[model samples]
Target: MDLSGKVAIITGSGRGLGLAYGKELARNGAAVVINDIDRASADGAVAEIVAAGGRAVAVVTPVGTSEAAGELVATAVETFGRLDVLVTNAGILRDKVVWKMTDEDFDAVIDVHLRGTFTCVREAVLRFREQGGGGRIICIGSPAGQRGNFGQTNYSAAKAGIVGMVRTWAMELQRAGITVNAVCPVAATAMTETIPFLAPHIESMKRGEPLPAIIRRDVGMGTPEDAAGVIAFLASDAAADITGQALSIGGDRLALWSHPQLTATDFHDGGWSAEDIAACWGQTFAGSIESVGEEFPEEVMPK
Candidate 1:
């Protein structure tokens, strides 16, 4: 996946998973545009990339607005001459149960993860079209999006919406020679270090200690760099035919997540009334009700 001569914009790339992605893309020869709301962090990330012999520039801005999104694309083109890839990785967390979530909390998460992605991808697609219809759009997703996560109503909703758009965009942009896909990644970053189960591992990693296979293989948690390769592959010409897929990667694991589909189907002539459905509810659809979220009982997890 050689990206020589390509230009990429990676939002929220000042640190953590975003920074990892920016570095990997640049390592593969793509000139990167690093974006984040924090000016110091964004500049530091760019300096680090440049120090390591990569071409990189920073655009410090929150990505929810059309103007900011436009600026990111403009920076990529004006600085590097052309834009080839866009990674919508900017996001914020407003974790709360549905009943406890406020309007502000929900809106903040949606604005950054969902609407920011929409605006950024929209701008990138416009550039791709003007440059003659070929580009890559890789949106970040999560396990919460593919299934569900407790006390993460806003996060799950935003992530799920991102994947939803990925599917639609893949179809819409297919003939344009542009590919769209989502990557649901799990990594032990500052954001995940708050989790009780992952805290110790984070510390061990800081001391240069190796993680146990149980944590790495069973939990599928690893350094952000482990997930970065997926971005590099997806951004390369080798993956041009791999659009509309939701691929998960971390630690010793990498898997493809299936799209939502009907588990059961039935035809009712003239449309059956509610009363008619009540009679057969016990045998037909009731048993097929699928469980949602990350359903790992304590007994099943490796300790």
Candidate 2:
């Protein structure tokens, strides 16, 4: 799918998954506006894209604020003449169990991931409407948010909120022909190097060796590039009808995630009292109870 005349803004794209997204989208013919807090990295990314025969520009800035959001969109429009896609890939991680997580930890994650996504999408949507057509909004999400994680209270909350907004905005923007979706990506980057399951393999990655087949196929962990294809496709015309969906992508693994839905429902003649519900809870709801947290197969243990 070619994005020959499209322009895209990918936030936090200096490196890692965001960088992968920018490069992939550009490779597909989209002129990319790269956003990142680090000026050096942002400029380097833009240069790399240009060297590879792709059109790109850098607007180095920390996301999560309305000003930054406006600047990002403005750069896309002023430089490329129009904005066709936005990927809210900026985020931070503060891993701590609930008891140990501080207010600072929580707020920091929320500001970057949750608020950053909100402001960026808001700006992109406004531009799309002004352009008199539709656009693509791809918000980054996490598996931790879909199923709770032990030490990711803040990260999970922010990601969960992002997906929630995607669902809501998809409905609200349907009339305007805009598509909103979430991508839950898993890859080995600086952000995930400390993860216990992937930690042992960092050395291999540093050596430029491919991720072990077992890790990619069984554990679903891979390089950032493995997950970039989906981001690029979502930004292309091919995926215009796909919206309000949460998709998981990684090395050797791609799956469509089911949104929260009722597995079972029962009706009462009137309203069931607390005691009346307690009496029937075991039979009515106990069978459909779902487990939480990410599940790694025993075979996935790092050797």
| Segments of candidate 1 deviating more than 4 angstroms | 297-303
Q: Residue 188 error for model 1, in Å?
A: 0.6
Write down the lDDT of every candidate, Cα atoms only: 0.92, 0.92
Candidate 2 TM-score to native = 0.97
Task: Show model 2 residue runs off by greater than 4 Å.
Answer: none
Model 2 worst lDDT window (10 residues): 294-303
lDDT per residue, candidate 1, 1-303, as tens digits? Answer: 799999999999999999999999999999999999999999999999999999999999999999999999999999999999999999888777889999999999999999999999999999999998599999999999989988888889889999999999999999999999999988988777766667888899999998777767777878999999999999998998999999999888899999988876666789889987987777778888889977543633448
In model 2, residue pairs whose N, Cα or C atoms come closer than 3 Å (at least 3 residues apart or on different chains), thus clashing, are: none
lDDT of 2 at 187: 92
